[model samples]
Target: MFSGAQLSLYPMSDDFVGIITGALSALDPHRDHLRIETDDLSTLIVGPPEILFSAMRDLFVAAARSGTHCVLSATVSRGCPGEPDDPICTPAEGTLPVAPLDERIAKAVAAVKAAPETGQPVACQVSLYPLGVNQHMDEIEGCIAFLKASGVFDRPKNFCTKLSGDAGAVFATLQQAFTRFGAAASHVALDVTVSAHSPTRA
Candidate 1:
């Protein structure tokens, strides 16, 4: 299976360039673990799920620490058909196997509870698509149940679910949503947007 994300960070300030460049350092710790490439549009990170989300959290937190509003847009996927399988995209050790819907939900909730706190808080909205599956709705609803119980869940939006909390748990929940709902080898994708230090609040 191939897993990766195409991520773009946007800082709402005149120093966007500086903020973005400085935040790139946050990816240093994860560099050896992932295949990272940057271009004019976005950065591509390919690796295990745990490392992928952690790297993203670090980068976003770094930029947000500047007290500037920052938004991260990413398209994350696993088992993509067009992509060749790479050993680097291997699943984490002891990753949960596909199980009954209820079992997966319980485990996902436990993961969120166990996530390490990163001090920085963020708000994320995401939509999951489990393609080419007859039980797609079941998978989606199962993910919804998991999110509501994740502690970071904020609310349900029109087309996606909203989550807010420490960056760690929020990203953990996102990882769970990506990995747990779909079939073990099926194509699953997530459209996610995360924000920090936004001036406008509800």
Candidate 2:
């Protein structure tokens, strides 16, 4: 089992460099916890699913706090061949051979909940890709219904769902969505772009 992601960040402003640097700086503290490599195009992070998602949450939130429009694009994968055969990429007994999406989501939600509050709501946009699953649309629709009923989902935007609320509640909803869908689907991949401090933030 191996889990990793290639992430690219784009800050839609003239001060893009500053925003990018800020996000990288935030991730610096977690370097000891992950295997990270940065190139001109993207940053590759490899580690346990929980740690990867936690680091991503912190990096994205720090960038969002810059008060600029920022987008983080990531292609996440697991069980890749030729990856380092280390504990970080190894699965424990009784868990999926690939990265466990449910656990990853729980860890990500915890990270979001632990983030410092700014007296304003935070928002995140997410798209879930459940690969090799039958009746995928039905599962997606069910997840959407759960998100809406949870009251954290703001709306559906183009290819993703917008979630806004107190950070804890919003993240909890995310955890629920991932857990439910992941359990029903064979393989789940998520593409997420979050704005911790939305333009509407007070």
Candidate 3:
């Protein structure tokens, strides 16, 4: 199963357009469904749990960083399951969809804000990399042991295989998550999801 957060951004700016689009493109592939529609501000993306999950916990900071307000009042659309028809034509960027950092950070922040408080559980799953290919899994395991031993793993959990915290807590969590892992966690050739919540308006 998969999940994500849906967001309606307000007062969208031109600069944010590219950033939001890029982040959306980076994370959209993991979704069973996705969308970006024009709004009075700029655009709104419905990031289902499967698409972003709690990994987007940093959205609040991202929005502030982008200097935009992400409205919480949203209207969500259910996704129709099944593979999308292949486009008749292709572009230079190819078949992958895209969005910007403004949207990306907003999506993450909203996801965290909408996360269940207390009783709800979130996880941070880390993938260890050796900075170069051809490293053995055993070496990777050792590195993980050392990192965990550093006492970082004992922190509160959020999302699935990703960070989860209150709106104020996620920015730093995401920083570490992104740094040790590839910025996009591509070294693992996988996407980070921030699910474990129901839905939100923003």
Provide TM-scores for the models: 0.97, 0.68, 0.27
Candidate 3 per-residue lDDT over residues 41-131, each given as its tens digit:
4333444322332324333234434434332222222221222322321212332222333343344344334434333233334343323
Q: Which candidate is the best by TM-score?
A: 1
Please write out the lDDT profile of model 1 over residues 35-124, one tens digit for every residue.
998899989999988889989999999998998899999999988999998888888764437799999999999999999998998999
lDDT of 1: 0.92
Instruction: Report, for every candidate in turn, its global Cα lDDT versus the true structure.
Output: 0.92, 0.64, 0.34
Report per-prediction Cα RMSD to one decimal: 1.1, 5.1, 14.8
Q: Which residue pairs overlap in candidate 2's backbone?
A: none
- What TM-score does prediction 1 earn? 0.97
Candidate 1 off by > 4 Å: 94-96
Select the stronger candidate by lDDT from 1 and 3: 1
- Say which prediction, candidate 2 or candidate 3, comes out ahead on TM-score: 2
RMSD of 2: 5.1
Two-way TM-score contest, 1 vs 2, winner: 1
Please give the distance, in angstroms, between residue 29's alpha carbon in candidate 2 and its true position after superposition. Answer: 3.3
Pairwise lDDT winner, candidates 2 and 3: 2
All candidates in order of TM-score, best leading: 1, 2, 3
